[model samples]
Target: MNWMEDGMTSIPNVLLQNYKRLQIEEKEMMVLLHIYSFTQKGISFPSFEDLAERMTISSSDCAACVKKMIQKQVVAIEQGDQTGYEFYSLKPLWNKIAALFESDARGQSLQQAMTAEKDLYSLFEEEFGRPLSAIECETLALWIDQDEHDPSVIKAALREAVMSMKLNFRYIDRILFEWKKQGIKTVDQAREQGRKFRKPTGTEQVTRSENAVPFYNWLEQ
Candidate 1:
């Protein structure tokens, strides 16, 4: 309808892929798009009123939208060099979108990892002879999700607890804690550590499956 520049303004492809998924409203998108347009046309840091007037939105609404965009990590503010003007940087938005794709492409691996986690959960329940408590489940989830512990390492810790007649989550957690202190994060590494220590295997290999009240010594240590 109107003739201004012959070329199109360049928006990052990452933004195009993930704007809606980030819960950005149309007004917010328009705000970012307008800022991008201003940047491309060499117009710097137009006031909120400038944006509101152009978009026919209220000034407060424009400000709120920009704030929401910033909260959602889709916009950033940068101080202009000695111009007393600020710019909205879109780099974080682009980076977040790129991370989303990187995560998506690993969907297959994530599913496989989930399967391994299910197997680990089942192994614990079977060995314990009861469904895990809510607190226990949350603890295991934290070990997997927050601590990023390997399933094999967890299994080894569980096996160690079983062999030591501990048969409790706390003791298993302690074993993991001790292993982490030694940087033993894998079954192979743990096994190698065991060989390096070469302690007496006869006393620690008893496979106690009987239900018993767990001791707090491990936690104390």
Candidate 2:
């Protein structure tokens, strides 16, 4: 039996469908799909230990599986100086594989749509100084794929958050939501607001709140 038939026999039909569309090795595919599940729920990428626990395998075996996946172009791996392995999806390859199983007319359109969205995300990252988190990247990708949001405005906000505020993903998201509530959608407007927020307020007080005391500062019982 072929890989597809084997997959159908061994794995659930819903999972098998996702696996086929990604064209990844069975072990790697299973782990990747599980990781993808966490992403769908707004969690960032899973760690090596997390992957090992989920797969019910040793860390070494999980490492090997991940390495093989990196080789297969199903996932991209980044090793940090102090931090460890970071995995990201190889969306282009997955999109191509997905297109192959779709109707010919729809396949071409879907392929084009995926490619365009990827290009737009590349532009977003380029405009921003640093890489986005997995959740942020996936959110942008989904929005672009659906063509429901303005890429230019989103890119501008991302750039403003990265450049003006010393903001991470959480802070950036907060600023984005605040801007949205205030009906500030354009890049220029975001940049202007960022500039205003960044200016030092001479009279601003650094008052400590009631919860500001450290754990060690609390009196012993």
List the candidates' TM-scores in order.
0.47, 0.33
lDDT of 2 by residue, 5-41 (tens): 5332223454466655555667777677666665555
The Cα local distance difference test for each model comes to 0.81, 0.60
lDDT of 1 at 1: 29
Tens-digit lDDT string for candidate 1 (84-174): 6777787888788878888887997889899999999999999999999999999999999898899888888887787689999889898
Report how far off residue 200 is in candidate 1 (Å). Answer: 45
RMSD of 1: 10.6
Q: Relative to the unseen true structure, what is the C-alpha lDDT of residue 91 in candidate 1, on a scale of 0 to 100?
A: 82
What overall lDDT, based on C-alpha atoms, would model 2 receive against the true structure?
0.60
